[model samples]
Target: MTSIDAARGMYFEDFAIGQELRTPERTITSTDIVNFACLSGDFNEIHANHEYCKRTPFGEPIAHGPLVYSIMGGLQYASGINDGTLLALLQIDAWRMLAPVRHGDTLHMRSTVVGKKETSRPDRGVVTFARRCLKQDGSVVQEMRATLMYRRRPPA
Candidate 1:
């Protein structure tokens, strides 16, 4: 492999339609929720107040939707699918939170390469990935389609 290839992960050309990538699981903790709450300044009762949640269907504090999404992003990055080959996140479409994420719920993501488009530029392309976040019980907690720009394989 060339130095350029060694420096990068998967490139735009490396992805094919229907190709899937599964990330390692991550367990959400109360501390994660608290830290996310502090960072986002979202002190909602459903996410931060146990007593308030006790009156609700969940019966306890739950994680923020954004926090789950953020963790999914981290998981994806950790998977090294894009690594240094990623250029930019162009768009996120059809983002849906299907279920609540509670503390101690382990989650992972399955990302499928759904679409690809070659740009006019020779060095880059666009790819759309359908990302799904599932909990330990196989329940889908969230789903989204992320369109991202990526570098092409460099010349030898």
Candidate 2:
């Protein structure tokens, strides 16, 4: 485990390759679907109507893929990455949806550090991670890599 600060004081040196950090579990509900629909203007029938979705291969109203991505991104912020020494998100790589996320399912997310390197800038560093989003059954719904820049510990 990477020795991250307990109360939002993370620095570049605290992260390690292959460290997995899990976010708090979240439940997806019908209201969440509606609210996301309103916010995103994605009125696609499969995400809105159970009846319509039942006719499809999925057999139930599945959450929107983008909504799932948004939830995964939100989970990162909720886990204190931004609250800690976050400076900026440098890039997202290979984001892909693997399975349908359905309403009423419990989801959990984790980010595993893939690599880290010091930047040319002495006061910052770059970290790369692959985040996994999984259902309560532990099936992966989404996976992606994010490149982040964080403030390094001050030179003593």
Candidate 3:
């Protein structure tokens, strides 16, 4: 097996408000939708029944909101921006599904550091990121603010 160097991502002190990271795009697929449905037990017709969805405003089965949210998490990880520096996912604030995500649609994420504060604990600090999931057409399909804790770099 080939060994790959682990990425030690930025610590809390390395983040600045307005710093943005864009992730690579990924296309949604029917298999992905089915797998997510099986894993999440969300069999909503809007997400699972193409025939039923054909009558809806979206005109076809759309991906689940939580599924898209999960993909955003993956996209962030793939960016390697928080590989090892992340302490915890503190909270998700103001999450919104702005548009439908249908199979075959390509999506990508753009995350901007919107807020940061030192915690009372000396070991970690909070950082808030404004994350947007944009479609191939450049329209936003989802958006949210995620607050996370990151470890502080040790003194040199």
Candidate 4:
């Protein structure tokens, strides 16, 4: 995995509501599409067969929605925002695929802290982030709200 940035990650207390974080751009390649298809066994024509896709509105093969969603996880990891601070992914809410992701489309992720709450455990907190996957053209292709458990700072 290529690390886009060597920056340090933040603890739960370090995040503020509305603070945004971005991941480095990644270009979707035909190889990536093929690999995802083989791995996922989702050999749907729109994602695999070019000739079949030519008959569709897209005019060409497009990446699978799940593939794009999985890539978002990689992008978030590459961003290094959670790193050692994340405890678990508690939930994903309101996930939507708004646009098709085609091969050669460059994409990036933008995440904003939308909510935060201290947990009764004291050592952990819950944070909600609104995340979007945007194409290079600035159109949002996918979006979701994610809730995560994060490690809180130890007492000073």
Candidate 5:
């Protein structure tokens, strides 16, 4: 189903392996970096100092990895596929930063269900999703696998 029709959250039983959901796009900005720097207390030159960044391979100030990762988390929620059905994030695995995210970069998240299993609790289950953060050009800038807890379908 399209995002418009699937705005409601999905239950554990609703997910199928290889099923993909794309989130609305977002643009990265300089103010985002500044705000993140202040909020995270991470004043790294590569993230907040243009002059310092000019000497680096990226040649420009880049957003913090964690900041972009955090944005992906928000995108996941905004996608609405995990809305109220999601219970908790169990784990993040093999998270990798493959490219620098700079100001004006439009990005979106693609989440695919990769695995699922019933838990001891009949009311909930575990789901593993492969998440990819892609730039407007279709380049994957970051990727990770996350395990989450989700409720099962309720009794009819």
Candidate 6:
């Protein structure tokens, strides 16, 4: 990976409604789940203890919802959609978990700008986007709408 300068921040003016951004594929493995489980203390049967999950309706272990959500961060950074520019995640809305994410699944993310508005402060703006995580087979695993604070490009 190339080194990045983190000094600059994105301004709300940079985004357009209907703009689409996609990320490269990311493979998820058992170790990834285990690490997330240990790091987040989310040791639920579906996410960590596979044998215990066999008794559930899904009949197998699934990834945690927040774990799936975390994928968005990787997507954002890797895709250059928010790289070095994003200031903060302000809010997320209508977050939904769909099909279960199993080990060895490949995931990708796409986001579309739904709206954008300039902030009262001249240096920043708010951007709202609809985001989705999809499996290799194109099945949607999770979806949400997010709002972020972005810094404006400095005047030349």
List model 1 lDDT by residue over 30-95, tens digit each: 999999999999999898898999999999999999999999989988888878988999999999
- Candidate 4 stretches with Cα past 4 Å from truth are 1-7
Candidate 2: segments with Cα more than 4 A from true spot = 1-9
Residue 155's lDDT in candidate 2:
64
For model 6, residues 25-109, the per-residue Cα lDDT tens digits are: 8988888888899999988877776688888887767778888788768867777767667888899999998888988889999
Query: What digit string (tens of lDDT, one per residue) describes model 2 on residues 9-54?
Result: 4688889999988988889988888889989999899888888888
Q: How accurate locally, in lDDT, is each candidate?
A: 0.93, 0.86, 0.91, 0.92, 0.93, 0.83
Off by over 4 Å in 6: 1-11
User: What is candidate 5's lDDT per residue for 1-156, written digit by digit as tens?
Assistant: 643433389999899999998999999999999999999999989998889999999899999999999999988888887887899999999999999899999989998999999999999999998999999999999999999999898786
Model 3 misplaced stretches (Cα beyond 4 Å): 1-6
- Quote each prediction's TM-score: 0.95, 0.89, 0.92, 0.93, 0.93, 0.89
Candidate order by decreasing lDDT: 1, 5, 4, 3, 2, 6
Q: Pairing residues by index, what is the TM-score of model 6?
A: 0.89
Winner by lDDT between candidate 3 and candidate 2: 3
* Model 4: per-residue Cα lDDT at residue 64: 90
Q: Backbone clashes in each candidate structure, one number apiece?
A: 0, 0, 0, 0, 0, 4
lDDT of 4 at 121: 96
Q: Model 3 over residues 59-146: C-alpha lDDT tens digits?
A: 9888999999999999888877788888899899999999999889999999999999999999899999999999999999999999
lDDT of model 6, residue 107 = 96
Worst-scoring 10-residue span by lDDT in model 6 = 3-12
